[model samples]
Target: MKKYLKNYIWVILFVIFSIGSYFIGFKPGLVIYSNFNEFFLEMISFIPFLFIIIGLFDVWVPKEALEKHIGKESGVKGIFLVILLAMLQAGPLYGAFPVAYILCKKGASVRNIFIYLGAFSSMKLPMLGIEIGYLGIKFTVLRTLIALPLFILVGYMMEKIVGSNFKVEEVKT
Candidate 1:
């Protein structure tokens, strides 16, 4: 109980704030409620499907295969592969964390993982269609071409600064 409570204190505080806002007036409270409801609905519709895919990926793909393809020695091929994978994915930014964790555990390089995350956050494939529709194909293409190199640069810089062996740090009580 204590562990759960400690983990969720922010949620509890947010709930309290929401309730207080409700009592104070509708403009703030009702707006918050409506936004929360919309976001929750979207999350419910999207996140489960993503989690199922991640679970299957975790179970089906062998660590050795991941290592061979995306490990430290995989070179430029690994960078391109990771970017392609990230672009192909659908879901919120939060969905990337589990996939990143799995990749790290399975021996993917830190630089490639960082590149994957940068692409995932900035350049989703599905969103490109919408971007081209609204912003024009030239604009979309230019943005992607520019961002790809920057993301790769960031990945390399991060790896250089943090070292390749960086792993998820455990939280202590």
Candidate 2:
């Protein structure tokens, strides 16, 4: 019971705050609660499907394939591949973490994992269309051109800081 309470303390606090606001007629608290509720619901709707896809990827793709494609010695090819994968993926940035974790577990380099995360956050293909529609082709192209190199640099720096011998530990369910 204590462990469960500790794990869910934030949720309990949120519920208490929401109820307290309702009783006190606090408009800002009520609005925050409403927004939180909507966001929570939205996440719940897609998280299950995301996990299912991640599970399939974990099972179907072999470690050797990942190592050959995106491991420490994969070089520029790995960077480009990870960027392409990041761009092709569609979802909120939070969704990328699970995929990145799986990639790490499967033998992907730290550099490639960071590159994947950076690109996924900024350069998703699905978001590009919307960005172009609002910001025009020139701006979008320029931003992407600038972002790509920065992402690579950041990845490189992170890899150096984290070291080549870094490894992800398996988590038991």
Candidate 3:
């Protein structure tokens, strides 16, 4: 019970907040309810499919295959591969979490996982296309050019700070 409460403290707080919002006024409560409903709908529509896909990937893709391309010793090729995978992926940032966990378990380096996550957060291909449509080709290209290198740099820096040999141990939840 203590562990469950510890893990879900924020959720409990959110429920309290929602109740307080209702007591304060119907409008505030409705707004919160509507937002949560929309988010829940989106998660149901998208996240389950992503989870299924990741599950299949975990089952079918050999760990050795992942390590060959994104392992600690894979060097520049690994970096490029991670970036490519990240850009191609479509969905919310939260969707990448499970994928990253799988990759870590499959022997992908900490640096590469960080790079993959950075690219997922910043350079998703569909979002990039939308950005180009609204922000123009030059702005989108410039941002991508700038952000990619920066993300790589951040990944390397994090790896150094955390320890060059660090790898994620399997986290049993």
Candidate 4:
């Protein structure tokens, strides 16, 4: 009960502020109320979709399969594995959380996970397709070619430097 209350404290505060604002004839506060309500509703609406996809991924993909292909010991194959995983990833950057959690538990290398997510966030198929559509193949390819090494370097630095200090319980960013 305490945990639940703590988790929902913001929601409670928002409701109180909203009701108080509405009764006090505060127009700006009402604008905030409406905006917060719309954002909250939209966020809530995606929960089911996120759960369905995560659950399916958990059920379909085996731990051994991921470990063999994307494990810490995969050597040079890890790069290809990360790219493949990134290519197959779905949703926006935040959507990687569920898969990341699963992969972490399943012996996926933290280093590879970093690279894969970096690639997913930057060079996702959907993003690439959109870029190609808006710009040109040359631009898309050039952008990707440039971004690839940067993302890889970022991933490596994240692993060697940031990983040492990071706590698994809270989000880093």
Candidate 5:
């Protein structure tokens, strides 16, 4: 019971706050609760599909292949591949973390993981189309040009900080 409470403290607090706010007629709290509910439902609907894909990737893709392609020595080709993967992904930024974890476990370089995350946040192809449609080609292109190099630099700096020997530990369910 104690362990369960510790693990779910935030969720418990959120429920309490939502209910308390409802009784007190707090408009902002109600709005926050509503938003949380919507987001939670969205995640619930999407996460299973994401996990299925991740599982398939884990089982089907050889670890040796991943290491060969994106490990510490992979360099520019790895960066480009990571960027392409990020761009092809369609979902919220939060969805990228699980994939990153899998990548890390499968032997992706820390730099490449960071690059994948950075590119996913800024350069998703679906979002690019929307941005171009609404914000014009020039703005979108300029943003992409600026973002790509910055993210790459950030990834490099993060790799230096984290060191090339980093490895992710597996979490037991």
Candidate 6:
């Protein structure tokens, strides 16, 4: 029942938004027509693969095993790992949530979750080539490098302030 309701939610949202959009009577024709394929393509391309990777990670990387790498003690090493992990990822925020969800479930620390999301949000190395092509290597690298420390800091602060409810609760010794 919960699962059915969850799936129904999106359909409901789509209907509401479509109806609202029509009544809003704005010039959405071009915006919707021009972008629908791109949006659909992105969803099809990213979401399934993201789910598979997350499922695989959950299966392969046991909670006890992950403690060595991403636990609280890992600190800066964990931050770097998160950055690399984020850099390797592609697609939208939804693409990354499955991994984040599993990480939280697997005893990954709250601070690390913040770092992981921050790192993932900040480091788009997969798109660096496009960024460089459109802008320049120096520009892309400089921006990312500058943002790196800030992202880590933000992650740290967020973990401290938001507390750990954002992730699965684990007993702290």
Q: TM-score for every candidate vs. truth?
A: 0.59, 0.59, 0.59, 0.56, 0.59, 0.56
Instruction: List the candidate 4 regions with Cα displacement exceeding 4 Å.
Output: 1-67, 164-173
| Model 2 TM-score (2 dp) | 0.59
Clashing pairs in 4: none
lDDT tens string, model 1, 30-50?
A: 787789888778667655665
What's model 6's lDDT at 108? 67
lDDT per residue for candidate 5 within 20-72, as digits (tens), equals 99999999999999999987886676556655755565566454443347766
Q: What lDDT would each prediction earn against the true structure?
A: 0.79, 0.81, 0.79, 0.73, 0.82, 0.67
Q: In model 4, how large is the Cα lDDT of residue 111? A: 73
| Reference-based lDDT, residue 122, model 4 | 78
Q: Could you tell me how far off, in angstroms, the CA of residue 153 lies in candidate 4 after the best superposition?
A: 0.9
The residue-level lDDT of candidate 4 at 31 comes to 98
Per-residue lDDT of candidate 3, residues 64-133 (tens digit):
4444588778899999988877876778997888888888877788899889999999897767766665
Each prediction's RMSD over C-alphas, in Å, is 7.1, 7.4, 7.6, 7.8, 7.7, 8.2
In terms of lDDT, model 6 sits at 0.67
Clash tally for model 5: 0
Model 3: how far residue 85 lies from native, Å = 0.6
Q: How many backbone clashes does candidate 3 have?
A: 0
Q: lDDT tens string, model 6, 1-173?
A: 99998989976776666667667775674466347657677567655655665556556644443334776667778767666666666667656667777677766678887777776665755455445655677998898889878887887788889886666544433
Off by over 4 Å in 1: 1-68, 169-173
Residue 153 CA error for candidate 3 (Å)? 0.5
Worst 10 residues of 6 by lDDT: 59-68
Candidate 4: what lDDT?
A: 0.73
